[model samples]
Target: MATRQTLIEFIGERYPEIFALALDHMQITGLAVLLAILLGVPVGIWITRNKKLARYIIGTANIFQTLPSLALFGLVIPFMGVGLKPAVFVLFLYALLPIIKNTYIGIESIDPAAIEAGRGMGMKNHEILFLVEIPLALPVIMGGIRISTVINIGTATIASLIGAGGLGDFIFKGISMYNNNYLLAGAIPTALLALGVDGLLGLFEYKITPKGLKLARS
Candidate 1:
């Protein structure tokens, strides 16, 4: 009973500080994922317009995916320096592959017949893309975004190493001090944040998926 009370007191005492860390974690991750979507989706669309280039562009992003996260952060440090700038850049790179690949796949997967039908109706290329292709592809693209965001939540913890504070501050401090409560305090919240984002995105995915596609798949 006394131990339980102590634990409660411990969390209550640090709740404000921990909450601040969580907000930092969310802010950094949200910014990175947003940038990735903005940049990556366009790149994906452009690359698909040239099949020869798609392979090389996607190949390069694949290389970044294979690199160790810490090493990638280290690589960016010289150019971006420490703190939020470097951290956001590294996470942005980390997010690119999924968004790019998914966007490409989503767009490419559309039926040629459907595209032909659009052309027959006098739809311009851009019109077909915006009206037909993108709507159909959105679910897949959003899945990638969801995946990347969840990944960023966990990865953002490492940003603390570069002096970009987040929940990892608690994690590293706990590790250094051998405090289990502090460790759980950070780890639990991070996990919860990831799960929450995943769930919310999943709901959005369901909402946005085209009705015909949903029926076809069903």
Candidate 2:
């Protein structure tokens, strides 16, 4: 009870600062994930068309995924320097593998007979891709987006080290000062933000998923 009251007091005292930091955090995460979707989805779709390239492309993204977040940020610092650019770049790299891999997997997993049916119905390649393939593959692709969004939110805390200002400012400050209130202030919000975003995306995934897929899953 005391701890909860203390946290509430701390939040009350720092609400404005916390709100600003949260907005910064969301902006960084949103831009990174948006870029990942723009590039990753296309690359994913392209690799599906050229199976030989799938392994190599996915492999490269895997390398990015395996790199420690801090070290990746460090490496990027040389070219991009410390700021939103480098931070978003590193996060963008981190977000790529899941989105690309899931997209590829989702599209590839589609029944060939479905494609044949589309062709038999006089559908063009682009038409089949946009109308048939993408709709069928959306759930899996959304899964990737969800994964990437959550991961980005967590990792984005570290962006403060590069001068990108987010909740990590409070977190690192808490660490330096040994202030539990500060730690809780940052940590709790970050956790809640992740959960909130994931839940929203889950709802979106359900809504956009093909009705047939949902029925089949049920």
* Candidate lDDT (C-alpha), each: 0.92, 0.95
**Model 2 clashing residue pairs (backbone):** none
lDDT of 2 by residue, 1-218 (tens): 99899899999999999999999999999999999999999999999999999999999999998999999999999899999999999999999999999999999999999999999999999999998999999999999999999999999999999999999999999999999889888988999999999999999999988889999989
Model 2 lDDT at residue 80: 90
How would you encode candidate 1's per-residue C-alpha lDDT over 17-86 as one tens digit per residue? 9999999999889999999999999999998898899999999988988999999989988888899989
Residue-level lDDT for 184 in candidate 2: 84
Residue 82's lDDT within candidate 1 is: 94
RMSD of 1: 1.6
Q: Please report how far candidate 1 places residue 60 from its true position, in Å.
A: 0.8
User: Per-prediction TM-score, please?
Assistant: 0.95, 0.98
Model 1 ranges with Cα > 4 A deviation: 1-8
> What lDDT does candidate 2 reach at residue 3?
88
